[model samples]
Target: MSGLLALLDDVAAIAKLAAAQLDDVAGQASKAGVKAAGVVIDDAAVTPKYVTGLPAARELPIVWKIARASFFNKLVILLPVALLLNAVLPWLLTPLLMIGGAYLCFEGAEKVWHLIIPQKDHGPQQAETLDAAHLEEQRVKGAIKTDFILSAEIMTISLAQIEIDTLWIQAAALAAVAIGITALVYGAVALLVKADDLGVLLSVKGRLAATRAFGRRIVKSMPAVMLVIATIGTVAMLWVGGSIIVHGVHDLGWHLPYEQIKYAAKVAAETLGAANGFVTWAVTAGLDGVIGLAVGFILIPIVTRVIAPVTGWLFPEKT
Candidate 1:
């Protein structure tokens, strides 16, 4: 009887430990996911456009396909690479993160530039003649390729934020973040794509007049909502990118900009007595975004004039 009781107690203790570990994994994963929010928002905002012209029936299916590819990119490719890098060359993380950050800044700045000085479509004005299926496939491929880059950034950011000691714990936390972020991004994309359909159906078929009005409003508001999301995504990219670069510079022993930004934020906080936290954050974000925009503008010319030509030469078929 005593032996059986002891065995039972041991099992219970083990179960408790397992539960605690799971909780820790969940908590850490959530924190890591939050840290990668800027990239994640951009991912969600960018993905919806890929399905824009596709058949209504195919929207969710395409989103699912992209989500599956994103999962593979994160779990199968990036997770292992991140772990390998952590184990073999941890110092590489900062440089790699800064690279990703620079990319985000460039992308965000390009969007802003396009908005300011709308580009003339100089390429041959050709209508897309591809079959629907082929078009869908092409879009899916493009989205997945983009997702791969974004997923690499997300995983690296998550890995950087994790503070746990155990290898297995780190792996579990990363996997959780991967699955969670993929679902969150693709799920939001799916809903955004289908929202119009839902609105149309409600507008036409809803029994209540108010319901119909609400549906019409939804249908009307979608474009503006998407615009807002895109704007937010762009801002997030710039803010996060600039902050990363600034911090990276500091880590590399160039602390001038970082110190200046901090000082500015501190001054702003002191000026705003009641809303000190909000003021500080706003000042920090504003400075970071300005830096990001400047960097991005500098990169745009280099990329368009130098990188594009070299890439075209290297991959002539793609050009």
Candidate 2:
């Protein structure tokens, strides 16, 4: 009887140890996911446009396909590459993240520029002119390619936040971050895209007058909602990109921009004692966004006039 009691206590202790390790993994994953929230938001924001003119029946299906591809991109490709880079070439992580940050800045600034002066080429309309199946295929392929870059950034950012000494714990944390963020972004995308349909259903089929009115409001508001979401995403990208570059440069031994931003945040925080933390973060993000926008504007002409043409010439389409 005494021997049995000892065995029970030992088993309970082992179970408790496993539970503690699991909690550590969860905590790390949550922290890492927060670090990559900006990219995740941008991904959710960007995906809905892919189904712009598709039939309502096709919207969810298309989102599902893209989500599947995004999962594969993050887990099958970026996750392993992130781990390998961390193990074999940890120093490269900061530089690569800076590159991604620059790209994000460029994209965000490009969107702003487009908002100021709308482009002539309507990609969705042009795609819609082709066969529906072909348009779907092309859109999915393009979305996947774009997602690969964003996924790499997300994975790298998440990995950088993890300071776990255990290899298995690091792996577990990364996997959780990847899976959670993918699900979150795609889930949000799905909801946003299907919102119109939901509204239409509610408006046309609801039994109560109030419910129907609410449905109409949803349908009416969807365009504005999408626009707001896009704007937020762009701002987040710029803020995140600028912050990344600032941190990258600081890590690489140039501390002026980062230190100045922190100083600015500190001054703001001092001005608002009660809300110091929030004020500090808001100030830092605002300054970082400005820097990101400045960098993006600089890159635009160089990318368009030089890089684009060169790349096109070097890698002409096979067809």
Candidate 3:
């Protein structure tokens, strides 16, 4: 009886420890997810457009396909690469993050530029001619490729955010974050894509007046919702990109920009007289976004002419 009691106590202790470790992992994962919010927003925003022209019937299926590819990209490809970098080239993380940030800034700035100076569409009209199946395949491939870049950024950001002692903890945190963000983004996309159809059905077929009214409101709200999401995504990308570059510069011993921004934020906070940390942070982020936009605009032409050609050559398509 004594021996059995001792063994039971030991098992209980082990179970308690395991539960503590899981709690720690979940806490870390949530923190990491919050840290990668910008990339998450961009991922969500970019995905919906890929499904835009597809038939309503095909939308969810395409989203599922892309979501699966995104999982593979994050879990299989980017996760291993992130872990390898954490183990081997840890010093490279900041610079690599800065590069990813620069990409975000470039994307955001290009959007703004297009808005400022609309362009005539003169490129090859290839996709419109593609059959439905081919078009679906192409969109899925494109979305997955885009997801790879964004997922890489998200994983790197999440990895950097984790404050853990062991490799296993870091890995678990990253995996959790990756899976959580993927589910949230794709799940939201599925809902958003299907929302209108659901609304129409309810509006036309609902037996209750309130149901029809609710459906009408949903249909009316969708366009504004998309516009708001796009705007939020763009702003987030620029803000996060700029903040990363600023911090990277500080890490590299250039403190001028970081100091100036901090000072400006403090002044703004004092002027507001009691707004709270969120407002101050928002002000700081807006300033950072302006700086990032300027840097991105400068890089755009360089990227278009030089980087694009080099990347294409180095990564020539397989026959």
Candidate 4:
């Protein structure tokens, strides 16, 4: 009887330890996910557009397919690569992060520039008779390729944020983040894509007048909501990208910009008193965004003039 009691106590202790480990993994994963919020928000914001002209019935299915691809990109591909990089060339992490940040900034700035000076549609025009299936395939391929880039950024950012010492713990946290983010992004995309349909259905079929009115409001508001989401995503990309570059520079021993931004934030905080925290954050984010815009604009000309032509030349198609 005493021996049996000892075994029970041992099992209880093991169970407790496992539970504690699980808790730690969850906490770390959540922290990492929070750190990658900018990219995650942009992912959610951007994905809905791929389904825009598709049949309503196909929207959710396409999102599901992309989500599946995103999962594979993160877990099977990016996760392993991230772990390898962390284990081997950890020194390269910051530089890689800055590259990703620069890309984000460039994307945000390009969008802003396009808004300011709307580009003429100069490419070959779409056929009057659209091939729905071909279009769907093209969009899906494009979205998955985009997701691969974003997912790489997300995983890299998440890995950088994880502070655990054990490889297993880090792996667990990254896996959790990958799964959670994929689900969150695609789930939101699905809802955003289908919202109009849901609203139309409710507006037409709702038994209650209030429900019908709410549905009508949803239908009317979706476009504006999408616009708002896109705006936020762009801002987030710039802020996050600029912040990453600034921090990366600081890590690499260039502290002037970092110090200047910190000083400005401090001044704002001091002036705001009770709103110190919020003011400080706002100032910091604003400065970061400005830096991002500057960097992006700088890259735009270089990319358009140099990189694009070079890439085309290097990858010339076979006749």
- Which has the better TM-score: candidate 2, or candidate 3? 2
Whole-model lDDT for model 3 versus the true structure? 0.89
How far residue 43's Cα lies from its native spot in candidate 3, in Å, is: 1.0
Quantify all predictions' global Cα lDDT against the true fold: 0.91, 0.90, 0.89, 0.93
Candidate 3 accuracy as TM-score: 0.93
Please report how far candidate 4 places residue 263 from its true position, in Å: 1.4
Off by over 4 Å in 4: 121-124, 127-130, 316-319
lDDT of 3 at 69: 90
Which has the greatest lDDT?
4
Top model by TM-score, which number? 2
Segments of candidate 3 deviating more than 4 angstroms: 1-5, 121-127, 313-319
Q: Which stretches of candidate 2 lie over 4 Å from their true place?
A: 1-3
lDDT of 3 at 275: 75
Ranking by TM-score: 2, 4, 1, 3
Quantify how close model 2 is to the true structure by its C-alpha RMSD in Å.
1.5
State the lDDT of candidate 2 residue by residue for 1-319, as single tens digits. Answer: 9999999999999999999999999999999999888898899999998888767788989989988988888888888888888889999999999999999999999999998998897875786588888778877887888888999889888888998867788889989998899889989999999898899999999999999999999999999999889999999999999999999999999999999999999988987787888999999999999999999999999999999999999988543
Writing each residue's lDDT as its tens digit, candidate 4 over 44-124 gives 999998887678889999999999999999999999899999999999999999999999999899989999999986323
What's the distance in Å from true for residue 55, model 1?
1.4
Choose 1 or 2, whichever is better by TM-score: 2
Q: Rank the candidates by lDDT, best first.
A: 4, 1, 2, 3
Query: What would the TM-score be for candidate 4 when compared with the true structure?
Result: 0.95
